[model samples]
Target: MRAALAALLLAMPAAAQTGDLVATDALRVCADPANLPFSNDRGEGFENRIATLLARALDRKLDYVFFPQVQGFVRNTLRAGRCDLVMGTVAGDELMQNTNPYYHTTYVIAYRRDRPVPERLDDPAMKSLRLGAIARTPPIDLLLRNGLIGNARFFPLAVDTRHESPGADLMQAVADGELDAALVWGPIAGYQAKVKGLPIALRALPTEAGVARMDFFITMGIRAQEPEWRRRINTAIRDHQGEIDAILRDYGVPLLDAEGRLQPP
Candidate 1:
């Protein structure tokens, strides 16, 4: 029934293994204050909406420690005793225990709907087109092997996202005809396309096409010692998947089921 979003430490974790990070009175979440379509301080992102749902479901006050999702996000927020939950994490991240995957997504080729769709990175038509991708993402390697990098623009990866929107900038280039197409994470392209009503079509890439892994299953993260907390989150995810899916779809998230079928809203 209550909430707090603070940039400073509002709660501290105990050094001992006593489940101190898990909040008993509030559903405390660790989130990036400015990472849009995922999280933001304004509570407009899908993760913020979902966290609200989780807090409501658990009958706890909603709370957050707002930090940028940078190098020490886990150590400074969830691990340092400031927050209890992270709404989205790669499924197998070693720094924290993960709940059951809540959704699956992949890298995508984003092009104007009026243009010829490129189904894969190796699409022959792509060779002649101006392309864009993030510097360190999986598509860069594929672009290199396909001899497409020479024609591609690679944006800096993992920039200080708190004040930057590299993904949106890259997608906008495609929409503006600066680039014929761009390869970006599905969620980023999808969210921007939906929000701006951009006429972009996104083509999902394979998880493992012998170049680099692209698809990812995203899960909630909690501390390693919180088995019961992890199980609770799993149950929460299972029970509220419909609500979760709706929120993601509302935010233009491209999703796939566990069986790999596209979930189009």
Candidate 2:
């Protein structure tokens, strides 16, 4: 019976093969309904705005397939034929073909304004401060390498998307004095720090030897079989680079150049 079931499942067409990119009137975007600075149901995240722009450029109405961006996000949404695009993803994801990079950002430090900020992982002051960062993140590895892990508080890398933003929680802890400082993703740290009215200073961490590169280029993700669709998305990204930069700036994303210097709007 198990072999028969397995054979039946094998006969089912793969999602991508079942649905080709068709000329549609609505641009279907897959997004996290609660993740801010990236996406949300209210269309307030930078990726939301970018999706809108992309839809408009393509002369299609904007629509979204809202889901929590957690484990199996790509498989359950994009690969399940529920949406046509993911507005923001790592540039070189192995699960899907990626468009040309739209923006680059890095990990950042979030600390209370009144407290001394440790600009680098190797700062001597960090040895004494109670640092916080998401567990399994690049920053945590850096902390461990520099012997700062002993004093660090680690949060879960994947939180329940239903009720938590780990980055925001870490920043709030900093503001409330429970933590001396926190290392968080640049976009989330900057947006949360400003929007939550926390008296915090956000600074992008510079790349250093022995630390994994903190910077990453972001791009749109499309099904690997949809080359024409990927090309269209890339064209839209290239045509609206200036507008996309503006949206990212509004969200306080720490845009950086290849040389690691901050980019101005």
Candidate 3:
């Protein structure tokens, strides 16, 4: 009887052996422990929520390899094989295989509610206000082209890996009266302004020249060798796009449709 059973199992299709051949263990994700709106150690960010949803769809437990999202982040975590996936990355990033873009967003202007918020880069009001931006970011170049660089306060883009995100600091400055306005990434600014309850206004920028094109499509990052894994993830993303969009909405992400209109959740 045992010999007959072994022969029967071996004769079954390859698909029938998928459970034994493929590992459905934990989904090990690489994330920043302190990057809010994306991820954090406390699992309060949108990326954390997305990770959870993906793991559930794959019928696997969720786990994280926490690292700061500074220089050498990929080398130390994903490339080092400490984790099998990164939940959030630019779609065209060359460092790893990327899944289909899950969301698109643009840079935003953040300012205290008590002050005037300029909807466009050329607003006359921008010239009189104290502008702030992260160094080397697209917004800085916009400021330069507009002749606003001389008065703009620049925050460093690269900080010690141990430090908190400088993006948060720039947003906080707008809320704390340190800056009249700030140009920051849309998701971060939206999360800070709407979700985090900061007293600031967040507005999307209108398309303009020399603005470094603030928009971007974000995707999940996987190792080059993980083509099958990437396909699975892409399937998951496609299957659960509605749920994913809801998660982004809950986190106050400024989502944009293909036509560039604001997609209200």
Q: Lowest-scoring 10 consecutive residues by lDDT in candidate 1?
A: 7-16
Steric overlap count per candidate: 1, 0, 0
Error of 3 at 130 (Å): 0.4
Any runs in candidate 2 off by more than 4 Å, and if so which? Answer: 1-23
Q: Which candidate leads in TM-score?
A: 1
Would you list the C-alpha lDDT of every candidate in the order shown?
0.86, 0.83, 0.83
Checking candidate 3 for backbone clashes, the offending pairs are: none
How many clashes does the backbone of model 2 have? 0
User: What would the per-residue lDDT of candidate 2 be over residues 1-265, giving only the tens digit for each residue?
Assistant: 9999987787654534434654367899999998887888998788899999999999999989998888899999888888889877888899888989999999988888898675667778778889899998888777878898899998887876669878778888998999998888888887876655678887777667877888899988888767667777889999999999888888788899878787763
TM-score of each: 0.90, 0.88, 0.87
lDDT for each residue of candidate 3 in 1-265, tens digit (9 for 90 to 100): 9999998887664444332323457888999887787888999899999999999999999989998888889999888877888987988899988999999988878888888766776777778888888899887778877788876998888875346578888899888998899988888888887788999877776657645677889999987755567788999999999999998888789999989877764
Model 3: how far residue 99 lies from native, Å = 0.3
Off by over 4 Å in 1: 1-18
The reply for model 3, stretches above 4 Å from the true place, is 1-24, 160-162, 207-211
lDDT of 3: 0.83
Q: Least accurate stretch of 10 residues (summed lDDT) in model 2?
A: 14-23
Worst 10 residues of 3 by lDDT: 14-23
